[model samples]
Target: MVAGLLGAVGGGWLVTRMRLFPALLLLGLCQALVNLGYIWLVHSGPNVGVMAAVVSAEYFFSGLGSTAFVVLVTALCNVRYSATQFALLSALAAVGRVFLGPIAAWLVPQVGWSEFFVITALSALPGLLLVVALRGAIDRAERARVH
Candidate 1:
């Protein structure tokens, strides 16, 4: 609940203040920030307070990132096939999330917790880079979103 609220607020702020691609890059960066919390947990071991805070932070950022992603997918969709495109994009995302879980499980054993989290953080970069690459499309989406 708290995370959802924070995420909505973050999303609202992003749409109002920044263009789509930049907002997406920012959202990805924020999403990546949560990995540091997990890294802290691995290094310091978990205290109840830190654990709670980290969990909330993770959820908040996840919510924000998810919202931004949904918006981006929606923006990218053709108006004639909006529903199908959104569903397809969302399904692709779900597949990625599902597969990543297993890959993470495999990776954790090889890398240890801290490195795993670092790798997790690094994973966010590609999305941000993609946003950079798609700046033109994003601007068009932003314009469409406005009017």
Candidate 2:
């Protein structure tokens, strides 16, 4: 909880000051890499300190990534349809959260924890690719808002 709180607040502040792409890319990358920490904990065996640290780091990065994602979504919204678009986009974003659980459950047993985490980390690539593709659009939108 403390990690989450710190990440959310700190990330929000930091991201607000950053250029859009850098902030989003950094947060997304960090979030992806953080999942690998769990792989270490699993192999290292049960140590309460490591478990707490890994969980905290996960929460921290998740909070940061969530903030970055919201910023991207909000930045891309049209003012005329801001509410509806934001709602729709937000719901679309939750699709993975809604479906990935059962998928992960099935996957974990098949690949084991270490490989599962590697796959999880790699899954961030598609989103990062989208961010790259949308960079121009996001810049245009921000420009529209400012001017």
Candidate 3:
């Protein structure tokens, strides 16, 4: 947890030098570390009950985080598209949850704990790339907004 916090601070500093979209992408990559920690804790020789508790906590925190993200996304959307875009974003989040269980099941057994975490961390790379790719557009759009 200490290391994760430090990484977040460092990443945030580094990201500040980047344009908006890329910074958001790096934010996603940094956020993925939270999942890595949960995976580590679950696989760290804890008993089933303890593991379940940890898992529950993780999910609870995740839902909180998702709510925050959704709020932010909603805030970022144009007024004209607010309802439709927010609905779409919420739907995508639901789809992500649906796929998560299967993905975890498939990867956890095959790669074990350590490798599984590495892969989970790697999963954020595309979001980082998306931010990079969309940086200019994001900046322009944001700058043009009335807000």
Candidate 4:
């Protein structure tokens, strides 16, 4: 876990410095694979049902937290206001921690491990779709600048 976090930080820095889309894409793919691996590991252990429930609750709230952060940050940003935008983004990140533990505890008994991770993995599809849809706009923006 520590290594993964450190690697994420390093990957983010590298992406920023290199301004490389493929690197970011690879990092995102790696994160998904890692998450899937974690789910597989949990399911393979004893108490599969309990583990599934716990992981499900953990990731559900995590998704909510991530969504809230993204929305709040996007709303606060002025396109021209970088500093204040990012600061507000940082503050909103704390909202996730408040319910993370309790949610996990509450969810474990209700859902099994395999289904929980599978659902979480499926939730990522919407974001992927959004990126796909935006590809055309991104290409247009790039093309416009070339002229």
Candidate 5:
């Protein structure tokens, strides 16, 4: 919880200092890579230290990524209907988790922990790619917010 709060504050500050697209992409990659810590935890067995480190890293990065996501979504909204659009976009953001929960459950048994973590890491690529592709759109939205 402390780690996550720190991360959120850090992320908010970092995003203000950097370009949103690159910051978001970097944070997304960090979030994805952090999942690999679980692979180590699973293999090492009952070590509380490793577990604490992994959980802290995971929460920290998750909070950072969430901050970036909120900023991106807010930037994308128009002032006229910001409330409605933000609500809709926020709900859409949750679709992956809601839909993928069962898939993740099934996937673990089929692929084992390490491979599943790898795949989870790889799953971040598409979203990152989408950010790359939408660079122009994101810039335009940022400009709109500024003006």
Candidate 6:
């Protein structure tokens, strides 16, 4: 709960201070770091402090990352098709979670906790790359919204 609240606060700050793509990139990076923290938590072995810190970081980043996603979705929606588009995008996000669960479960045992989380953490890279790749488009869209 505390971590979530922190993430909410961080996300709100990001929304106000930065453009959508930059904010999403930052949030995505934070998410990847948080996954690394998970590997540390798993290896630390019975250390409550490590567990708390990792869980907190995880919750904070995940919530903030989710908020970024929602913001991006909102930015992308066309008013004419917003209802359906938003629903579809949001559902796809939910499906992503579902899809990852089994993959994570299966991989964790096969590759070990550290490697699994590392792979999961690195998964953020593609989106970050896309953000960079589509910077011009994102900027134009935001500019269009303003003017």
User: What lDDT score belongs to each candidate, Candidate 1 first?
Assistant: 0.83, 0.89, 0.61, 0.50, 0.93, 0.84
Model 2: pairs clashing at backbone N, Cα or C within 3 Å: none
Clashing pairs in 4: 52-113
Error of 3 at 36 (Å): 3.0
Candidate 6 residue pairs in clash (backbone atoms < 3 Å) = none
Q: Report how far residue 134 has shifted in candidate 1, in Å.
A: 0.7
What is the Cα-based TM-score of model 5?
Answer: 0.97
Could you estimate the TM-score for every candidate? 0.90, 0.93, 0.61, 0.50, 0.97, 0.89
For candidate 2, write residues 1-147 as lDDT tens digits: 999988888789977798778888899999999999999998989899999999999999988988878877887898899999999999999999889989999999999999999999999999999888988887786667667
Greater-lDDT candidate between 1 and 4: 1
lDDT (tens digit, per residue) of candidate 4 on 90-137: 776566558656875666667866556565566556655554565555
lDDT of 1 by residue, 42-97 (tens): 66675888888888998888888887888888888889999999999999888878
Candidate 6 total steric clashes: 0
Winner on TM-score between 3 and 6 is 6
lDDT: which is higher, 2 or 6? 2
Instruction: Rank candidates by TM-score, best first.
Output: 5, 2, 1, 6, 3, 4
Task: Note the residue pairs that clash in candidate 1.
Answer: none
Compose the digit string of candidate 3's lDDT tens values, residues 1-147.
443344445544554455455446545654666566656575667577666655554454444334334434654677898888878877876886698879899878888887887787788777667667866767776566524
Ranked by TM-score, the better of candidates 2 and 4 is 2
Question: For each predicted model, how many residue pairs clash, with residues at least 3 apart or on different chains?
Answer: 0, 0, 0, 1, 0, 0
- Per-residue lDDT over 31-100 for candidate 6, one digit per residue giving the tens place of the 0 to 100 score: 8878889878888899999999988889988889888777777778897998999999999878878888
Native-to-model Cα distance after best TM-score fit, residue 142 in candidate 5, in Å: 1.2
Candidate 3 residues lying further than 4 Å off, grouped into runs, are: 1-23, 39-43, 47-72
**Model 5 stretches astray by more than 4 angstroms:** none
Candidate 1 has what TM-score? 0.90
